[model samples]
Target: MAKQVAENIQTVLRRLQEGDLLPVYLLTGEENYYIDVLSDFFENKVVDEVSRSFDQTVLYGRDVNMDSVVGMAKRYPVLGPRQLVLVKEAQDIRDWEPLMSYLDKPAPTTVLVFCYRHKKMDKRTRLFQQLKKTGEVFDYQRIYESQLPQWITDYVESSGYTILPGCALLLAESLGNNLSLIANELSKIFAVLGEKGAVTASVVERVTGISKEYNVFELQTAIGRRDVVKCNRIVNYFAANPKSNPIQMVLPTLYSYLVRLMIYIQLPDKSDAATALGVNPFFIKEYANAAGNFTLGKLASCIGYLNEADLRSKGIRNAGTVTDGEILKELVFKIIH
Candidate 1:
């Protein structure tokens, strides 16, 4: 399923570049990054600059209805071979019946694109089913946390620059799974580094202002090695900068790391552990060592601590006036002890 979604995006882009344009595109998904990219491509790439003035139409779903959209799509181009009709925020369109009917026999001379964001069309619905058969549906789901590092590397390489694995890991750990933000930050770094130099941890820190030594990645390493001093130091640093390192982000990342460690402890064959954990082979050694340091029982207890910390961060059942730093400090002590 994952492989197919990734390939679908590439295939769509390739088709667009090669001029094998689809008449109708249903771009709906939880992730808006790909939807924006592909929809922008159709808006800019489909019509030539000179012809777009007459042949291109951009509408907002909140401002227009299905009948009006269909009426415009049925019209012929003024001075070009085809016309481009793009609808942004298509999820706001209340009536899908008319659009589905139009999609059944779409105009051959028009390229219609629906940029539906933040949600997907129901497969069980007649609209989705018919569109699946007639037009192209690019369902852009959010990439998993495990797939993020590779995505960062691929995004960097595609931009005509190289990034080290450690640099990618730092970006992933600091930025979490927000691809849009990551892409923006990488663009800033690329602007400085240009296409020739490699993006290192220093470059990431210099450009993005994320510290290399004091981050979730290093905190995990410190906990895995049972280095109480280092753990406290990183926790203190995070506590000092609550906005940058919120207890909300810290707890989930620590919980995920421990959960993966617990899974590693159970696997009989450790050879394919990296694949199982959805982590890079380069960081598998850290997980292996952490698994050795902490037993399944300890990991389970650590998860419980994480849950408590999460609740405290949300002010649920958290008595008195405890700062986020205090919560993290206490959570790290519990985990390491």
Candidate 2:
């Protein structure tokens, strides 16, 4: 499923290169990566620079209504081969009658692109069905957290760089599911590596300024092993550097770790643990040991402690002015005991 979705975007790029242009493109999706790619292609590539000033009409959904959008699309290009009308953040558009009517017979000289980010267009609407018949309509699905490592690997290779599976997993676990930020961070790494070089874990750490040893993953490991000293060391670092290690972010990682640990405890089969947990096989033994230290009931209690910490961090049910570091310290104490 991931392969097919990835390929679909590639096919669109391939088609664009071949000059097989669609009259209108509806790029609405949960993942803004592909939507941004397609929108950028049209903005910078589809319209030549010389005529772009005259032919390209960029409008935001908040500023313009369907009437204005249809008005701009229906106009003939003065200088360019085609008029490119791009509507960014098109999810703000509510009324679609004027655009729907125009799509009934869209202008041949116009290429309309809609970048509707982080949302799905209602397929039940007449406008959606009409656009499907008359133009390109793509709904990019959100890539899950478990699928990020492979996605990172594919993205790196596509950009003429090589990364090991473990390094990719590290990136995936650290960055979570923010594809835009991940892409930006990867760009920084690639820029430093020059035309082509192997992306090592050390290179990633140094280039991205991510202190792997002091990160939330290490904290999770310490907590899992019931290493009170190690856990406190990391927690103290996190508390001092609240800007980087915000409690909101730290809480989520700890919560996810405990939940995964709990799931690991319930799994009857241990051979396929890595596959089940979407993690590297090398870490399975570590998790196993941690799982031994933390029973299902203990894990549940830890999660509850984490929830309480989150509420306190947000000033909900917090009896006094509790510092983030103090809240974290209390939570860790509860989990460890």
Candidate 3:
């Protein structure tokens, strides 16, 4: 009954596959990969398509209060030996005291799964405490940019596909936080490659339509080196392939990098500061060298440029139609100049 934190999505699935059918399950996170996987797992294990009737129910926590959830959970299973109850988007619920009370003595024949999306329950909440003590809890935090390669490799391997390390990072950057979309993309790529095939950087490039030669990372590198020609070329490349190399994609990563640099600037120019920022030590070494090239004022200006670019990308600013190349060129000029 000790609190178990499922740091990895696969770890939670392994537990479920091992038949760790707890009476109550509380899954909450921004990552939908874990939520969707668990929901599907419960749907298959708890209710068969032919047998699903009164005993199986899927409810949204937003529309239904704790009383409604408790009421359904308390109900006896019909002709079926067990009841399957799933509460999706549980973050929408206002109050959960009633639900917590019911967890004290959950119905023996009921499997209640509460899938909280985009947020987590307050640890101080009684039900959360109870879940930590008795129920299964899975927390799927987003994988960091650096760790994404290994994560993708493992994910693809688990799904009966082999991906080269270089292609893994390429996929991670291309797909970003959209795991479902990434999976779908990979599925398509795999189908095109056929069985017993390995995914190389070039093969991934050919199938996914994201070139390894010119990507956001390279663009950032170009900007960092103040190579105007390379920067303009990358921007043009993105403009030519806006679907795969969207403008919105670069802002988040650029903003994140600048924010980290600002944070690093405050700390002593030492390796520990980079380590504390959770960046790669090599990047830290780079930053240690690069930090001197720009002032706090310049970094702040870069952030402003990213912010303006982000707004323009979202169509919030720069109302007139403008090419992605122009926007990116302006952005690069703002930071570099």
Q: What does candidate 1's lDDT look like per residue over 13-33, in tens digits?
A: 888889998788889888888
Instruction: Look at candidate 2 and give me any clashing residue pairs.
Output: none
Instruction: Assess candidate 2 and give its lDDT.
Output: 0.86
Please identify model 1 stretches exceeding 4 Å from their true place. Answer: 1-7
Better of 1 and 3 by TM-score: 1
Give per-candidate clash totals.
Answer: 0, 0, 0
lDDT by residue (1-337, candidate 2, tens digit) is: 4556666778889889788998999998788888888888999988889999999999999899989999999999999788899999998887878887788889999999988876777799888899899998878888877778888888888789999876787787778788888899999999999999988888889888776777787888888889999999999998888887788878987887788888889999888998888766767888899988987888888888988889899999887788999999899989988
Candidate 1 versus truth, CA RMSD in Å, comes to: 2.1
The lDDT for every candidate, in the order shown, is: 0.87, 0.86, 0.76
Question: What lDDT does candidate 1 reach at residue 192?
Answer: 91
Error of 3 at 75 (Å): 3.1
TM-score per candidate, in order?
Answer: 0.92, 0.88, 0.72
Task: Evaluate model 1: give its lDDT.
Answer: 0.87
Off by over 4 Å in 2: 1-4, 280-282
Better of 1 and 2 by lDDT: 1
